[model samples]
Target: MNKELWEKAVAFHGHACPGLALGVRLCEFVQQELGVGVSPDEELVCIAETDSCPVDAVQAILGCTMGKGNLLCSRAGKTAYNFYDRGTGTSIRVVARRNTAELSREERRRQILESPLEDLFSTTEVKYPLPETARIFKTVTCAVCGEGVAEHMARLQDGGIVCPHCFRAYDR
Candidate 1:
């Protein structure tokens, strides 16, 4: 990983934690594996298994952002990521070593920042389709909450569009 890139990541993530360092290394490995660099647009997609400090690094270095509809989170609470090339359909999954969990947060961060690439993570190639629903959505106004909701996320309740939150409220 480039020192300059790590600096940039630290600047973006607002700290120099282990998760951020791991993400920086993951981005570097992914770029090398796919023979590509930071995406100019939606050329690459990152599916992170958890919402953690590393996610910010992936966003900064890989050019996959939630606003762009390219960064997806799995909410699995694991430090794993899947990088997919939209143009070639190639993807790779990277997971941090489980033993890292044994270390204190500060020690883990220190190790991640100082360790070699191979020592920090295990990676594998995978095949998975980018969902059609991932890219496009229609915006609608929820009648109950009056908040804007994606059409796919809105439900029809009492002959009016309602967001999941509002719908759940009605249910309760």
Candidate 2:
């Protein structure tokens, strides 16, 4: 693991923890195993199974971010991540193993950092199709809330265009 990259990830994440270390290691493993580099664009995509600290490491190292629409959250509440390379059509799913042994916080962090990729995660080829690239939808004002929303996200409610936030389910 690169010390500089780890420092940057810790800084970005506000603090250091085992979870963050796992993420840093996971990204490094992907780079080495896949021979891929930082994404300048949406060439790399990460569908993280959790909204945890590790996703932050992935965003910092791989440049797959929510703003760029490359970092997606599956909210499956698992220490798993699915990575896809749009350029090569290669995809991988990495599931980090839980450290069940009783250890102090610092000890746990050190173990995660020092463990080999094969020991830390179960990596496998992704079987599903990769998600479509981010789209640029036109913006339209919601008639109900007078708020601007993506054209595709606008909902037709009571014959009026409304944003999802302002749309209400009608019974009649």
> What lDDT would each prediction earn against the true structure?
0.83, 0.89
Q: Candidate 1 lDDT, tens digit per residue, 37-119?
A: 88877888888889999899988888888888888888889888888888997888888876626888789877877778778
Candidate 2 positional error at 82, Å: 0.6
Model 2 global lDDT (CA atoms, 0 to 1): 0.89
RMSD per candidate (Å) reads 2.5, 1.6
Give the per-residue lDDT digits (tens) of candidate 2, residues 1-172.
7999899899999999988999999999888777788998899999998999999999888889998899999898988899998898888898897778999989999998888788998887664468898999999999987989999999998888999999997879
lDDT over C-alpha atoms for residue 153 of model 1: 89
**TM-score on alpha carbons, each prediction:** 0.86, 0.94
